[model samples]
Target: MKSETVGSATLETWSVEEVEQAFAANEIVLIDVRTPQEYIFEHIEGALLMPMAFFKAEKLPGQTEKRIVLHCGSGIRSEKMARLAIDAGVTKIAHMDGGFGAWKTAKKPYIGTDMASGAPKRVG
Candidate 1:
């Protein structure tokens, strides 16, 4: 776990390995803060879409017990979202260290558009 100071709040961050472990254990709420088209291109498996364009802190899943982790194509959008979450009174929020690009560069598993139905399909 890593921490970033944003204003008076602290935003925790996780690496790809940590994110993957938490995901496999179902212990985190993974969110992708990118556009629908960007998400359709590729994303970490199990990530929920909550594009920053239409982001509303209140709309985020109210799963207080679970750690909330956000990510984007790179890390910029996720950082912005983290700040918004902090301003919204959310604490201990997190984002992937390098976002989807890093996750892919590390050869981590993901899901993306299916050739046939244009739906999502898991890929390793």
Candidate 2:
């Protein structure tokens, strides 16, 4: 059975905690659907960038078994990219409800390309 609580509704949507747990359990993959700069500025730990502009980037990290969670600064771009991922035959696609901002607000850990402080640093 599905083991995650998303909201007050019966339908469970992916939450920051769920994503974190998935990462901890090594059951999911995080993908940043923002620009390369934004990705370097901030993103979840281990999240690979597939900038929304390059729609095709979705195909690069093509792995079906992994539950793919996509996120952006505010969630909009991630939602769009999630659809693309789904269209590309990725059925286990989801978007961060509130996106990176919410993830930061929840105090979830992240790692930037520059430093390992869990805060956005810089990309090499």
TM-score for each model: 0.87, 0.72
Candidate 2 residue lDDT tens string, 1-124: 1323223212124777777788789877787878888776666768877788886734646455676677888878877776665555554557777788888888877765545454555332
Residue 34 miss distance in model 1 (angstroms): 0.6
The residue-level lDDT of candidate 1 at 119 comes to 80
Error of 1 at 51 (Å): 0.2
TM-score of 2: 0.72
Q: Which candidate leads the pack in TM-score?
A: 1
What's the true lDDT of residue 73 in model 2? 85
Off by over 4 Å in 1: 114-120
Give the worst 10-residue stretch by lDDT in candidate 1: 58-67
- Per-residue accuracy of model 1 over 1-124 as CA lDDT, tens digit each: 8997777778987898999999899999999999998987887767899999999987777666788899998888998898898899776689998899889889888987798988878887
Best by lDDT: 1
lDDT of 2 at 37: 83
Error of 2 at 44 (Å): 1.5
- List ranges where model 2 is wrong by over 4 Å: 1-12, 57-64, 112-124
